[model samples]
Target: MRLFLVIFAVIIISGCDDSNSKPSTKLSEQQSSSLLTIKDESVIPETEFSIVFTPNNEVEIIDAYIEGVDMYMGRIPLFFSRTNKQLQYIASGMVGVCSKNEMVWRIYLHYRKNGTQEGKIATLNFVVTNT
Candidate 1:
């Protein structure tokens, strides 16, 4: 009886440990999938993001105006391009909508070529990562 009880206890502890770790694994996976990586400020359809500057030529984002609570543009910029331009912002302060490791955000991209303005506001779902 004593041996049986000890085995049962060990099994219970192991089961609990496994259960607790499952959520963490799932969360990490979700986070990884949602992370957004901006390469050279280019927005592509799947992997990279790019801004459509002209019908034939597309340039990377160089600036952005994030919408605020009252639909106002944020004063400070959150993201930038290598050109040292304001290219993105965390509109809602990175909470709620961006609380989860994988979240969605409403963002704006500002890019231009020559004297033509060609960026627009858009919504993107990205996984927030430290890297």
Candidate 2:
């Protein structure tokens, strides 16, 4: 009977252990930055640059694409990486080419927050210094 009692007590103790319980996801979740950064803001076409993306929140997946906003360049897919909370990429500069002195490119970002099926989109624009 004593052994049975001890077993029951152990079960009860384990059941009431809050220390092992996972914290609320909503509590730890906060909005992150959508637009990351480019090492050089004065971007030059066909030149590579270091870019980073910080999603608005933890995400399961993120996909990005770039296209010319001021000229004719079809949407081109881009690949990047997520380390901790930041996504890094070495962009192969702008594909936009036109008669204008400055070329404009728009990046469309799509992401799915961690533990969710709902998706989000962010739009960022940059100019190429046709120098």
- RMSD (CA, Å), each prediction: 18.6, 24.1
Task: Tell me how candidate 2 scores on lDDT.
Answer: 0.51
Off by over 4 Å in 2: 1-33, 84-96
How well does each candidate superpose onto the true structure, as a TM-score? Answer: 0.26, 0.60
Tens-digit lDDT track of model 1 for 1-131: 67545633432342211110000111123223221233333221112233211112334546653232322222223354342233332221221121122222234444444355754333333332211
Error of 1 at 53 (Å): 13
Supply the global lDDT for candidate 1: 0.29
Stretches off by above 4 angstroms in model 1 are 1-62, 65-76, 83-103, 121-123, 127-131
Give the total clashing residue pairs for model 2: 1
Q: What are the lDDT scores of the predictions, listed in order? A: 0.29, 0.51
Cα lDDT for residue 24, candidate 2: 15
Candidate 2 has a TM-score of: 0.60
